[model samples]
Target: MKVNYTGFQASEVSPYLEVHQALKAADHRNGKPDVLAYTSVARMNPYQALLYRSFPDHGFAVAPLLKPFELRDLMLHKSRASSITLHLHWVNWVLAGEPDAQRAQTKVSGILGRIDRFKQLGGKLVWTAHNVYPHDAAHLEAELALQQGIADRSDVIHTMAASTTAALAEYTNVDAQKVLVAPHPHYRGAYEDVTSRAEARAVLGIDDDETVFLVFGALKEYKGLLRTLEAFDQLLDQDPSGRYRLLVAGGADDHPDVQEFISRGLLHDRVLMEPSKIPGSKAQYFLRAADAGLVTYTRSLNSGAALLYQSFGLPVLATDTPVLRETLPPHTALFLDANAAVDEYAAQLKALRALARSTTQTDVLDGIAHLDPSAVSSTFAQDLRSRLGLRQH
Candidate 1:
């Protein structure tokens, strides 16, 4: 049941299913690829799975997880396919996590050099601007250079939000001409939404009276858990009826505030914090049990969590970030000012509770019907193919 969020190969999964996937991948390996990916996607996230599902007929496989210097090795084995396209998702990999500015700059330069070599070898590159900048930035200068370099060399710069162009432009120059706006697809078919609130509540032992505000995803500091916990504590203090509850289920980072929140037993009754990655099968339980999804992100460029909540028909109580402005569907969200105080977020939480009570769940679910994966998958797949200069079948 315990996975390191990255390394855990829990027995909760079916070996037969994995082998089936592997067999399919093997088939793609033997055939010439129409579109091959080079991404550092973690084992936990379903974004990659949902994405590649767009190409059922075409031979699309994750080619490799090569490091910056190691990409040159791919030159030895060239695909004979007319289009040799590679999508490098999360370009921050080379520039992120290095604290030393000089080292970070060096890392960026080395990757840039590799990218130049890849271009020389006739490999078309498409860069997805997933984040404006890392929330926990250690070297801003290096990251800026990396972003600029990627934008310059990318045949297509795919962005999920139009606001991302402006947000990223604040730090690095973004070419509007090359930018393609492909909205983050919802998790409609990714997780089952068949579980009713009553069934889910009983499974989690949640009372029907409790106004559950669910916080799902990795328990990172930039996720604004401190402010969220503070705001939740404030709400509980004001309401003696004990009708409110906050359920935080995700893998925890080593943030001191979050660690304290995880350690404390005082608020266990009102605040249920599951400090681990929730498995895919169990995702429905959290989604169906909650009245509304809660997110108090301090800063972010993209929020898949918002889309996940929307996919499941749960309205979100979220910080009003530019990304969320473009991402959230109508009548499905209660926004708190991104620059607001903890007390203001608490007020929004209360407002969200009110909103959830007034609106029918069917109405909320209907709001996100347009976001079904089938709706966007074909468009996104086509845009990507066009950018890569691959002719549509």
Candidate 2:
């Protein structure tokens, strides 16, 4: 089938490069020559050097067919392809709030009209539910309407966590039968030339004895950054010996809540903050320097960060949510109640810190064994073929 993959940012933040590598490797082993192309905002540049290097011989190319607010024309052009796998991009914009309600309605109308036209051309629509809803959705009602529309039209819906199936149905009213539970692939061996934990810590100026709790990735309001800081502060006060340090590393959002936290002088020598985009080459420093990774998401259905932490052999301390509980086993991660008091969270952090110190490398490896990328890719390829009705060679 001629498949066009959309919503993939060919940047360091996205997991598309890893996913593409795994899928391509699977295809090579299976001797399948499926034509796969990705839609990007622009042509290849230095920013996509890592992705290009990884998949040099893989039959993947960047096709600049889609642009923002041009869904109708793009879909009409891409209708020649057998299918379009919508990842996580266009829907967010379509559902985003505009100051003029009429203008927003017009845009939605145009998108829906194009979707119908694409269907008329016998093109299949697939959506991967990366989140139950957009993390930064401004117009909830409009976004829901668009979600429901997409769910109604989609031939297949993919979700990383099985627990999110019910939430997906609840939010988008998608038919449960159409949903497929595919675990998010592990990012093993994705980053190149990773530095050792000791060396990374030395570069970051972190002490050998201090237990580091890292809150990595883009810093957003819903990531529970303030709550994490509060819990870490309490832990420091309770310990009094300065045994733990909180490292908040990631690009900061323009939201007032995050700005307010920064303006209050909350960041200091102990509470280290690296408010910048972490490149792929330097990502391992943050991941390796830490004793444990902190995923303090106030609200989320799935966490790529938790998987990343496990991939890097760091025990995870994540917020207690059904999706997280289902995705990460008790042995892999220790869960904290999102609604718990600061003291309670601090106590949990302390316990996790102790656990991290006691946990062995073998135990960490065993915990993350299920996230093997080869196995994940094989399953993903088989599922895709089955869903698309492609005959096995």
Candidate 3:
């Protein structure tokens, strides 16, 4: 049996092959796809999927880079590396969840070796610098080694913020010549935004007058979920009216402290805790219910979650990081000192009690139309094709 996938094809079904791979077994005539996006998302997550959505239109085949983090299979099939471009995004998967520095080094070393060999085979690589280090911020040596090695080899170091080059230069080697600044897409059309605010709040048991402060995305420490929780605790202690409702929802992490803190937060009447990945169909419920997005990232090169908030027309309460300041317009968000005290956080929350979003959803979208995913990805694909000297469609 044969099936077509996004105009790419599979001659026979194979569980191991990505959408780009055909299961004919012997004919390696068309091996791996032309563009492989390595990501932190699930195999078909919108983050990576939407990125290359315009690729097919631009005459390129795309697929998620499958596991084992090596190109040995391509080598085994005698595939030419010149035909492929590996796009890396938040590649902490190379750490393999090993906290120990020694084991971490071994894992990173293996992947680096494979990348080196891929380059040797005439492959070009594009690395999107999503973070300076992994969320846990562990194993400085191994992380730095991996990034420095990649920076030296990457044909383009893509980033969502202009500050990426300077921010990364503080800790790792960054060749400015290799840097390319692009926009992070707002998840406007990605989520099912079917529910109205009233209906969402009603289902979620939120009160009409209460202002919901949403802390979304995975509960990683680097994202400042714990700090957000701590401020909510202080806010509760100081205010009796409880107008500020804390809505913490997302895929929870396995870290003991994070799990414990979020667990404690669930007990509070003012706190609404989903503590799991919200289904795409239900993503709008939280966004529509909340008035302001809470981003307490201690460090970040860029934030898709922030863009996600603005996509739904909600303003954000974010740490005043350089990247956020540069990427987001001032009208779309209220900034907080990144290194402020818990008291300062509580005060900020107090100040936000009656705050209203200055910009409507339309205005938010209009301000950055140039950065819209459709345009940005199309430009990216066309530019990529030009860089490779591929024929223009």
Clashes of each: 0, 0, 0
Which of 2 and 3 is ahead in TM-score? Answer: 3
Higher-ranked by TM-score: 1 or 2: 1
TM-score of every candidate relative to the true structure: 0.87, 0.82, 0.87
In the range 29-123, model 1's lDDT, one tens digit per residue, is 44555535456555567776666666644444334343434565444435444445557787666766677888898888888888898789987
lDDT of every predicted structure (CA atoms): 0.73, 0.65, 0.72
| CA deviation > 4 Å runs, candidate 3 | 1-16, 19-45, 75-82, 237-239, 357-359, 387-393
Candidate 3 lDDT trough over 10 residues, lowest sum: 6-15
Writing each residue's lDDT as its tens digit, candidate 3 over 170-239 gives 7788888777776776677888988999999999999899988988778876777777778888988898
lDDT of 2 by residue, 133-199 (tens): 7788776666767777777887777777777777675687878777767676556676654589899
Predicted structure 2, TM vs. truth: 0.82
lDDT of 3 at 225: 70
By summed lDDT, the worst window of 10 consecutive residues in model 2 runs over: 42-51
Between candidates 1 and 3, the one scoring higher on lDDT is 1
- Residue 373 of candidate 3: its Cα lDDT? 75
